[model samples]
Target: MISAEPFVSGKYLIDGNWVDAKDKTTVINPANINEVVGHVALCSEQDVQNAIESSERAYHSWKRTPLEERAECMRAAAEELKKIIEENVSLYVRENGKVLVEAKKDLLRCVDIMLQGADEIFEWSKAESLQGPQKVIVRKRPRGVAAIIMPWNSPLILTFKRVVPAILTGNTVVVKPATNCPLALMAFLHVVESHFPPGVINVVTGSGAMIGDVLCTDPRVRTVAFVGSTETGKDIIRKSASTVKKIYMELGGNDPAIILDDAILDEKAITRLRMGILKAAGQVCSAIKRIYVHESRYEEVVGKLTKEFQHIYVGNGIQPDSMMGPLNNKNQFDYVTGLIQHAKDSGANVKTVGIKLDPDTWDQGYFMLPSIVTGVNQQSEIVRAEQFGPVIPILPFKTIEEVVEMANDTEYGLRASVWTENEDLAILLADQLDAGAVFHNNHTIFQDLHLDFPGAKESGLSRETRHCGMEYFSDSYGFAN
Candidate 1:
């Protein structure tokens, strides 16, 4: 690890240069509050405006660049990214507080997205000749400037999914990094922005309240891409009305997992289920939020699942054996704690497990053990709300019909999963789920990338995009560079 110097992103990148800011935001290590992982420059409203203006100017020239030339530059950057992936993984662990394994995977995914995105976008965005009643020459055109607002969890991958497609299509972007996790992405972007032309890629760091409106409402930005809460997404939608921007949003999900009567509950299946809930300390938007098992197998399922989760090691991500780290921030930590408390108050049986790596200093970090709750009412906060923490509630379902209804009863529908040995039955049941992505055996696995749907009707045009290529949509093509 690079211990000699802690990562610092003290300048906002605007017009291809790192410009210093008067105010700054210090990123704290969620595993160790005393450690200042990094500091990001907090830009003002004027700074955001400058970024948008620069992106607008860049779009004019960038759109004229050859498609092959644009693809070539992005491919080279993807190669260079391989060199820094490990270093950024370490930095991500320190600043973001996810396990080292997940940190590496998240950073590595960024490189793949770029490399594959280049080819996919290249093919998709090229000019097309077609006959529809009469011969037509069709070419995709760039949408001018795009505003990409990201979240802290999976920072690099989340930001790049939008960034690569936007830039490859010749739309310049002003990126807003999450307040607590900007360090790694800023560093990653620093490497990438240099590969592109000046003003093509810009970044601004600050609270959404201070600068987000400017990014979303500005007419210069033709599209607004955001990944955050439903409430925030709605707020952006309201603001974008004046400008009528093309908005792409990936919001919250209380994804459900149904354990069929014939579902496999072997060691491997149980481990996968545990990771589904505990991964990123359950900060994932589409992670399994609630589980419904056949009433006959409810006790057995809880016994086996808790046994696996209880063995997971919770500690600082930098450690060798730390399987999972603390939640990324205090607000998230507090909100999760409140969720557990409320569930308990409502007569939910919460089984807290996991051995703290450092029991003597447990309070030093924003750590919470895996909480497996039972007896939770369908309407309780823990059951209904998206408890984005390492806490999951297991409910008993007597019939498939009843469970399907219970699973469909939610405002959030990012993704869901059904675990069963019955293949035909699984596919039939999956068709009935209201969730965008319904998996028979798994969800969020790399193999399941093609199975995911972009978004449910309730959630806006949001995709749980991990390892998704820019050519994800068969009919959709980019603006030819």
Candidate 2:
């Protein structure tokens, strides 16, 4: 067990004060036998009311501040955020069960998104010349008190994606990070509160069902930003609509990757595909859950992937050799395990990769071997639903048209990637793929801060990034960078 010193001295930055929650929720290190790393304060309804009122009071003057001044505040906060890089990664790995290297990557990615928001402000401020002297200065101003409800999957990046733009756009915010992964976002808000004024960025961590409802329905919040599953996003949309508030959502994704026969089954391509499906234990919404491979190369690709999966080193994240760690929490672990069992019982070909390690040691923690499923028919449950685990369910297709149709058959259209060495074939397949973002030669992890990332159908409503993120703080028509 790792020794615990107070990593973050303060908690709950409410109206600029480092206080505690009325009730606290204990955060466990899942990889370490439910060890208590720290406690997150669960805000009461009264706490939510206070935060909203504080943001509302500050918005009066904050919204009037010049865009340059707002950008300066965001930059200062970003600098503070950068300072906590090492400390934040430590907390993330301990509490969230991600490998140390992956946690560091997340922290760095968060910084990039923050800087991107600052750099893109100039483009958002461009004024257009009208036909007459009545120059239409289409200024993109802050929406108001933005209530940001971020999920546990990617807390740091999600913070920068929403909080940075909301702050740069001149909107005061109250962040309610997913209780399971509040540590990193809490550290981030601490940096903001240190440099920015009170109420500019307040964080209240708590239960989503209880505290989230208060934040979403409160009249003081002009806009609500969320990143989570589809069911919860839909609920927030319904609640926010009653208040006539702007709702920005980034929900679930059942992404697919189509491998054409022209694709080379080289060592590099096979290794990349394995990493894409298994990263973060495949807990990500954009993780490649389905793969439609051309019939000719189907066996060859599966052979390569199975061999790669067999080599994964699963253990505690603190161990340097441990490439894969336990799932973030027990709920997620149980969910993934249940899904695997369901697939097995439903007659899908399930294969467990890597040695079983020690089942005796595994009983104390939530650990499962990375899974792969093949030979499942198109109408199987595994193909239709989002497993959200480190299991890739692959199907063989004879033609490009049939494969594209198979990829688009799902209720989701979040992301899809087509792998091929032939440029023309790759482009043709990418264009026909029905996803918000399509990759020609790689998996769906090809996300940059500048890209407009969102989902389609039951996935998500509005986009998030660059102007899309800035627009989260404004009316749908008002453009903001």
Candidate 3:
């Protein structure tokens, strides 16, 4: 068992003070389920009400604060977070079961996003004036209190991605981190809370099912920002309909990567594909879930991928040479394992790769080696569902037209990528993809802040990042003369 020096204290941040909830929930380390990382408060409905009321009371004053001053506070928070990145990275790995490298990337991305929000707020806050038959002025106003509901997969980044933008844009925020991995993010927020005024930022910890409806349906909360599964997003939309609140959802995605007949099967190309599937143990919203390779190169591509997967090292996050870590919780572990079994039972060619570094701890943890499933039916559960684990399905295609149709077959359209040496063909196939973001010769990952990162179709209801995101947190008012 790992040392317990960095145990997380179970407390909620309400009105700039650490307070306890009615009950507490223990957090387990996915790398070793026998290990207890810490505990978090399981807030009650009354606690949610208190948080919302506190945010409502602070919204007017915070929205009136100068944008320049708010930006300054954000910059200070970002710098303070940088100072604690190393410490938080260890906390992240222990709580979330991601390797050190992935944990570090998440920390860096959080800092980058905080700074980006500071810059974007200035651009998004600019007003517009026009003089013609009538003179008019339009300005943006904060949408009262914001409810930010985050997922566990990328807790730090997703939490801050909404929190930073909401507060910077003059909206007071109440954050709800996923119950499974709330410790790291709550600890990170503790460091930055001092930078903002009392009640400007608050976190409520508990079962989302118990308190999520309270946050969404509350009339005082003008904006609801969420990042999670598509089903949950739909429920939020339905609940928010009563109050008609502005909702920004970044839901689940089953992203696909296509390899053309003329695509290069070189090391770099294969590594890119491998990283797309293996990153965070494939527990990412935009991780490449499906791969459609031309029939001519399908066998060769699978061989290359299998060879690369053999070198992956799976173990506890703190292990020096470990490359991948266990799934974040038991539900996901069972879900992915069941999908793999179903595929095998259906005659799909399922192959497991990589070795479990600690066989003794395998059953004690939610660990699974990387797996590749080929010859899967297009309509199979493995193909239609989001595995959200370290398993990928590679399907063969005959023609560009057929592959394009297969790629766009799902209800999700979050992200897709095309691989080919021919620039003309790459662009041609990219344009045909139904996803919001398309990449050429690369897999989908975080995009630049300047680009819009919204999901199309059932993938999501709205967008995040850039000016588009800011619009979701503010309203426009017009003055005419």
- How would you encode candidate 1's per-residue C-alpha lDDT over 40-104 as one tens digit per residue? 88788889999999998988999899988888889988899899887777788988999998999
Stronger candidate by lDDT (2 vs 3): 3
lDDT, candidate 3, equals 0.87
Worst 10 residues of 1 by lDDT: 472-481
- What candidate 2 gets wrong by more than 4 Å, as runs, is 1-10, 130-137, 355-360, 444-447, 464-468, 476-481
C-alpha lDDT values of all predictions: 0.83, 0.78, 0.87
Q: Give the per-residue Cα lDDT of candidate 2 at 177.
A: 83
Residues forming the 10-long window of minimal summed lDDT in candidate 2 = 1-10
Candidate 3 per-residue C-alpha lDDT over 233-343 given as tens digits, one digit per residue, 9 for 90 to 100: 999999999999998888888899999999888999899998888999999988899999999999998999999999999998878788999999999999999999999
How far out, in Å, is residue 383 in model 3? 0.7
Per-residue error for 475 in candidate 2, Å, reads 3.8
lDDT tens per residue, model 2, 1-481: 4556354422677788878555786887777765877878877788878888888887888877787777777677777777778866777888777888998998888777777788887787665444554544455566789998888877887777788888777789988888887876677767766777778878777778877789888888888888888899888888887789888877888899888888877888887788778778787888888888989988988888999999988877766777887788778888878877888998888999875444556766667778889879788887787877778888999987789888888888888888888888877877887677877767745466777668878777776455637776764332333
Model 1, residue 227: what's the lDDT?
Answer: 86
Which pairs in model 3 have colliding backbones?
none
